[model samples]
Target chain A: MLRTQQLEYTYPGNKTITFPDIQCEKGSQWLLLGQSGTGKTTLLHLLGGIRKPQKGKVYVADQELNTLSSTALDQFRGKNIGIVFQQSYFVQALTVGENLQLAQTLAGHSADSDRIKDLLSRLNIGNKIHDRTNRLSQGEQQRVAIARALVNSPGLILADEPTSALDDENCKEVIDLLETQAKEEGATLVIVTHDSRLKAFFDHKIILQ
Target chain B: MNPLTLSWKNQKDRPLQMLLTLLLFGLGVGLIALLISLNTQLDEKFKNNLAGIDLVIGAKGSPLQMILSSMYHIDAPTGNISINEVKPFLNPKHPLIKLAVPLSLGDSYKTFRIIGTTHEYVDSIFRGTVASGKRWEDLYEVTIGANVANKTNLKIGDQFHSSHGFTDDGINTHDHGDGFKVVGILNKTNTVLDQLILTNTQSVWAVHDHEAEEKQAPAEAVAADDHDHDQDHASEAAGQEDHAGHDHSGHDHADHEGHDHDTHDHADHQAAGPVMKPLIEYPDKDITTLLILYRNRTSYQTLSMPRNINENTDLQAASPAIEMNRLFSMMGVGTDALRNLALIIVIVSGLSIFISLFSSLKDRKYELALMRVMGASRSYLFFLIILEGLLFAILGYLLGLLLSHGGMALLSGYLEEAYQYEFSGWRFFKEELWLLGGSLGIGFVAALIPAFQAYRTDISETLTTY
Candidate 1:
């Protein structure tokens, strides 16, 4: 469901970072391990179509990310690729249900409240659907973020340090939730992290120096 | 989900800042709208009462006061002038004069001026028709104006005594003679005539004539007591006191005969109608002013008549149009200052909107980036900011209109009580629509820079940084 070849990026100061080839089949999970300054977040942004790489291409669901216009790329990312950032960020003014509805609408689809309710219940955050995102607990917010990423049933899920701030027990639980949800949706999951605790959970790994 | 809904949600997030912006803009718009309505209504009232009279001839004084008193009945008349002095112009055969209506003042019944004039003043000048009863014909018979009838409740055959001055203070009243009877009620002309009590010039003369006779009797008795003194001193002192008392009432029974002779000669030379008879036959009688119309207003003689009257005659002549324009310009200074202050307020409110939006945008950058990552385009954020500004403008404009009309209604009640002049607040002016357009322009311009910043939000940088 996702492929990238020779992805390269440069910082403003002309510091260049290169990536190895990545190919993950549909419904498979992969781990991209990197320490700080290895451009792990940059790779996740490139693969999710949030940023364009200087010299390479990213393909998700047989469509190249660089070939789409800016507007079309934003739509495609919303419909096909979901990214979970290091922090649980949300539109603070909206409630949980409304935020999910906004995501569905911004992707040029009509709102599906039943699907949103179903996803939130499966993530164990059904009671938080009417609550503001700011009022939720940290663990509850993490679950809500996961639910939001899968709200549109995207084919690719990119997670950047999703469990770095959690304790070992919570970290295990969060990873279990991500993997289980991705399996249920038949989406390819890629986790970019420096945490050593998640090393034994995935079979395929890409280590960045 | 939509730009408008998002904009509203963002505005609701900071209620105090939004309310402050709306209040400032509303106050600015309200003041300007009040001035516009006041100016429009004042202009309408002034022009409606001007009534085609070319020049006002009165005793020499402030020409504007003369126009206000005689044409508008809002001020005291410039002292009185003898009717004989303007009799030549009053002749219907005069080369330039179209019509001359005499107005004798100096009496009132319950704060309404008793205007002593001929039927020509009512028929030709005001084109007044009686709504009930008939017009005044004989001495001591009077016709009440619409507002006079309404305020005083003086119906037909109601008798009321005249007071000495323009106001009814209960002292200096004419109590010796029988009260003047209300013979007619005039239809509302929406002019100065709507607030007056109309009668022939003789009724005003006769009301003061009784006081004249009583003073003369006391003076004769005092003169008899002074006969024991030097004859010259006694005669001179008596004459001075007597003349002081009879200054406005100088006519006697012999003067009436001479006035009749003059009227006969005037009638023989001009076409005679029932309107042609002099309401007061005494030649030495005084009138407050003469409202004159020209046969051909653009003629050289007509144009020069005011200059001729001002320079050569003892009377003062002022054109109603000229004096009214002078009045407007004099009032314009204060209105112009207020209008400038309102504009400054509007500009300051625009700046306030800009600052509020700019400052709030700093904290919302992360939220905006989240929206971008959720598939919102750059233009979506841009339009959302613009829509917030427009919402403020539209709401403020409506609030301003409501405030201005409400204030005007309150002020109109006071003005009607004080001046007896009608000022309506329910009327709308066309200039208010332009005010709406100007307010929207302010909103759009105020939002321009902030919207551009929102459009240029870098999602990758904002997301990772915040």
Candidate 2:
């Protein structure tokens, strides 16, 4: 579960972005929508504990993120939060499976190959597990990124414009994979994107202005 | 995966850079390792072979040459000292002298020198035992040293004609209807004796001057004569044994002084060539050198005797210890320069690694940030860069070590074949450990700035901006 209240952040140039209160229950799919310059990425970072808000009560898995030390926040984030970016950027030198395993390792969890294989099989990229991430097709790489996010069974999954680079068919397939995978892993999914096509996929929406 | 696997994958992502780093670092490490091994071994060999005799009295020439030629048997003899000229020190009645072993050098069986001396030289000075058969019982009966027998494949009873010069490939030959007979062989002694053919002084003279007709005494009679002569000298030498005993113990104490002063014991292996044949009295006889053992290492006679011989006699007295040090210092300058140059190469290689890592950081920032978002701490990212650096250094060191040994083995082969000199490539040096640590230190230092940069990478800025 993830929730944020009256989060306010200021950039170095004195620009401020005020966010609305947010809530996402377990296993629910939600979208954070905004036009360009609305600070959707800033809000995503704030919720993920990667950035500290100027003033806010940010909670993830029933714990106040800002109250934890940097090291503890890193540990807490690793164990409970998974993030997918706009573009698939796996460590290019590693295999698809290795990239997923890296997520588990960095999260301070033992590698679970069966979980990884099962996740990949659900995404139809299980056969490409040993293939280098850089050698995979764009669609397959996106699928691997999704697998990496869900490998640790995190409570919160934040996807920042994950399907923005894909064509219509690939965008639909990737979005479906992310939603279905997050549902299967029982994680609350929050996607921040400018893509209007994603509006129909999720019922819960928070539009940032 | 683990950090190591990640480091390896990172290296693989940039193969050219990785190879360049390895070669640069490897060459630097290889050259230094090779130098240390060579310097250690050469220094040991030079030090290990400089003991026993106090003076090397040979014909007037370079004292280093005299020592090298007669004592080490590595250079051409410095002309020849006549028996009459060297007779004062050789006399059993001489008060300051304890033992004088005469060496006659001119001929060779292959590369080994054919040395003619008295039986006392072999039995007393060298303390040698015949591995097979008996000591020479007749003229031209030669006792082969262990190395000579092994290299030339000569056996007892195998007769071999001597060449005219010291070289094995010399064109001039000695065929006087008499070839030297290998009547016996000496065991390996790890001294100059291992590379010589031993016979009586008369055998060398007879080989050079075939026209001299010599009256031959019965074998038993000559043996009896040498036995009488050795006994007379033994009794006379016994009266001076107290000083000699002190000299022996004093030399042992001097060993702990330093490696430069450690005296290698050279037990003289004498030939005696069937002392049955009477030797023509010394007057015009030209022997290569005379090795003298003093009654005491520090006796007033030992110090004054060399100066006395050099000033009063035609023969020059050379001290092995002094000449060898001069040789080492002279050789040291060139090798030290080479060693310093290798050190510079290692440093330059470290810089190259630094530049490569620094340049790669720009391209790797996005991936690093992704790792951070995946929950890797800043410290983990910092260590990843450092690990990559250490991996480069370790791989380079391993390759460099192999290159150095391979190069040394090649050089050792050439030296063995050309100069009969042994340079072992198998010896491990303590400096190698230092070299390893040095390489790792360089790697760590070179990666410092890049690793710090990785630690400071703002994950949110990198991820959002990209």
Candidate 3:
């Protein structure tokens, strides 16, 4: 459900980084691996339509990201592309359940507390639904972030270095939770991380240089 | 979820800054509001108390003082004027004079003035009625004013001595054997008369008959003085020395029967044993001031009468309208300056809001970017900042408006007691609408810069800025 072709980008007065094409089918998990300077975050940002790629096309669910107007792209991204940032950034004022509800609202879907609670229960953080995200443990925050990403049942879920901050046991658990949630939603999961420890979890992989 | 809820959370997140901003804004709004309310109410009281008399004739002194004293009774009388000196205006047949009410001052009970004038002073000047008892008929009998009766707790048939001068505490008390009896009390007329004790001019002469004896020289004055002296002697014989003992009980039985029976009984007691002859006549004697009304205020008399009195006679005549205009002009300088300063403070409060919002916007960039990513439009974030500002404005305005009215109510109570002019605290002025608009405008202008910054928040950059 996601594709990219020769996607490249550049910062002001900085060197250009060309990315290899990415192809993924629905209900699949893929890892985009790179070192710190290899544009792993940049590629994920481009695929989420957060930035305009300078050279090539990014396609999610058959819609080209660059062809849409800025406003339309934002709407399309909210509906189809759910992104989990490296560090979980929640609107700290809202509880975890409210954060998930916000994701549904921003995605133009009506609020579904049952679906949100069910997702949290499956993620093993259901009791923490009413707790502020800041008060949650790191592993629980990561699980809540995954619940927010899958709350709208988006076709594509993009996670940027989400497991890099976890230890070995938490990392494996987070990756398993992500793949399980993605497969349950039949979504294409793309994780961009510099941590090669995640290499065993997915077969489809692209290495950025 | 919504912009309003988000903005509220944003404000609640920073309680100290919001409170400081609201206080500064409230203080500015409160000062301007208090000044506006006071200025409007004081102007209303001053205009209401003018009472339509055209000219005030008194001894030569400051025209404003004479106007304030003779017309408003808020200052000491310039000095006494002999009634003979103003006989031209006092004459009923005078061409320019419609009516002249002579006033004799220099005595008071507590803060209230005891004014000695004819019945025309009450009927014509105040246009009032006796709320209880009858108008004074005997020389020592007096009519208490509504405010005087209320403030001093004096009832009909209650006799009280009026000390010399206008001391508020009634110091340097008079030693005259018999004090003036409260024979009648006038209803509230909302004029200067409400703060006065009304008695006939002869009562004033009789009470100060000793002074009249000291200044006796003119033939007509000596005749009037003798009449007052004879009346004083008769009142003394009628047991004036026992009046204090009778009133020492604090409540008098004389007024319980609807009229002053005690004074009539004293008169009858003198008449039963010895024949006391009533005086033949009271000449147009000395008075402290004359309040003159024009026959036609729109005619040339409005201009020429005061000029004619000032240039042609020994008495000084001042038009109330002209003197009041001068007083307003003098007061306007200070009030206008204060009003302008309040406006500056309002502007500074706006700047404080701007600084507060602008600084907080820097800290909120990541949160704003998150909202943008969560499908909040650029305009939504902009409105969030604007809504926060308007919330502060609305809160400050409501509190400030309350503060001003509360302050005015307290101030009006003190002023009403000190100067018998009533000021209503519940009244609202149309200018307050402009004040509200100005405060909102300040909030809007203050928030514009921060809201603009919020609108331009770069989502990807801010999200990644950490």
Candidate 4:
């Protein structure tokens, strides 16, 4: 479960953006729609506890993220929230399996090789586990990035413009995969994007202008 | 997943930079280590051969050369002086003198010097004991040092002829009478004594006596006092007593009267072996040098003995300690320059490490931020960078130690051949442990700025920007 109320942020030079209250049930998928400069990425960062809100309350699984210390907040985010960035960035020095193992260890969980193998097999890239992330194609890298996000079995999955760079068919396929994986893990899913082609995939939406 | 593992992975990402940094660091450490080992071993050898003797008296020449030739056996003798000139110190009843050992050097066997000295020189001065056979007691008998015995393979009873000069040029070989027999082999004393062939002064004198008589026997009837022959062999015979008297012309008649009385008493014991005859009996003879030890080491008279002998007497006296200090100061200039050069190389290598890490941080920004997003703390990133630096330092240090010891082993061969002093490379010095600490400090300092940059990385900014 995830909830936020009256989230406010101020960038340098006195510009401020206030966000509407949001609530999502467990295992539900929602799309957050926003134009450029609408502070959608800022809201996602606050929800993930990657940045502190100037004025806001964010609750995930009964714990208020803003009230936690920086260290505790980092730990809570690693355990409960997973963010898939717009660009598929990875630790270039590590192979796909080692990257997944690093994510599990950083989340304060012991490495589970079997779980990693299962996740990679489900993503149809199990054979690429030992391959360096840079050696993968664009679509494969994106899929591995998604796998890294899900490796810790976080309660909330956040996809930031996950389909914006993909073709129409690939976009549909990526969205279906995100929805089905979140459902299978029983995690609440939030996708932030401005792509109009993704409108029919979700029943619930929050539109920012 | 650990900081060390991550650090190692990052280092492997840039192999060329790591190799360059390590090479620079290793070369700096290796040069310094080599200097330290050489300095320590050289000091040990020099100090060990000082052997408690207070002063060296030889012919008036370079005092350092006298000490080097007589004490260290590394240089040729500073020309020979008459045994009569040194007779006062050789007296056992002299108040200030504890022991005065005579040395007659002017010959060698296969480049190893044949030192004509008494049993006291080997036993009292060097504390040498025979490992096999017995000490030399008669003319033409030799007790070889351990290294001489091993190198020349001259076992007990084996005979070898002497060459006239210090080196084995094969031209001035002494084929007179019978070849000198190896009577004893000395134990390894780890001193200059380990490289000499010891015999009584009579054997050295008798060898030249035969050479002189052989060359002058044909010309003796024609010209009895022909001074045209070489001065070294001219002083070898009793028939050259006129040349020895000419050397004593500057002294007073009373001293001459006392010397003649002592020589008659020594002649009464001439039926005994030449080793037991008083040195005064060989008044017409010459010796290479005299090693003197004082009865009262701290006495003012003992302290002034060298200056007194240097100014008044025709002989030159040198303190081994004073001469060795002068030698060390002269050697210090070269070692200090080498040490400074090594330090500069070390500093440059530190800078090299800093540049490589700082530049590589640009390429690794995303990976570092990704670690932060995956729950690595600022301190984690900081220590990861530091661990990489430490790894480089440790690897470079080990490589440096290997290189220095290997170089020392190679250099020891050439030095041993040239100086006949044993040099070993396998010994370790305490200074090398301090070197390790210094290397670690360099690693820590070089990593400081890069690690701080990693610690200050903005995870959100870095993750979203790319």
Please, what is the TM-score per model? 0.84, 0.87, 0.82, 0.86
Q: What tens digits encode model 1's per-residue C-alpha lDDT throughout B1-466?
A: 6667777777877889989998999989989999999889888778978888999998887898788878888666766778788888778899999888888876788878898888877788878889999999766789988989998999999998888666566865677646799999999988767888998876776666555445445554454432322232223224333112222533533333233223433332244233435633556678878999899989898899999999999889999999999999999999999999999988999898888889989988987887788788888888888888888888888878888898899899777645557777788989999999999999889998999999999888887784
lDDT of 2 by residue, B207-226 (tens): 64441111112332244543
Cα distance off (Å), candidate 3, residue B182: 4.7
| lDDT, candidate 4, B139-233, per-residue tens | 77899999998888999989999986666768668887577999899999998899899988877766755555565556554443334434433
**Which regions in candidate 3 have their CA more than 4 angstroms from the true location?**
A92-137, A184-186, B118-159, B173-197, B210-284
Clashes of each: 0, 5, 0, 0
Please tell me which model should have the higher lDDT, number 1 or number 2.
1
Candidate-wise lDDT, in order? 0.82, 0.79, 0.77, 0.83
Candidate 1 global lDDT: 0.82
Please give the DockQ score of every candidate, comma-separated: 0.55, 0.64, 0.50, 0.53
Q: Please tell me how candidate 3 rates in CAPRI terms.
A: medium
The list of candidate 1 runs beyond 4 A from truth reads: A112-131, A164-177, A196-205, B106-114, B119-123, B126-190, B195-197, B205-277, B417-420
User: Pairs clashing in candidate 3?
Assistant: none
User: Tens digits of per-residue lDDT for model 4 on A57-172?
Assistant: 89998799988876777678788888888888787778999999999988889999999999999888999999999999777887888898899999999988988888887788
What is the full ranking by TM-score, best candidate first? Answer: 2, 4, 1, 3
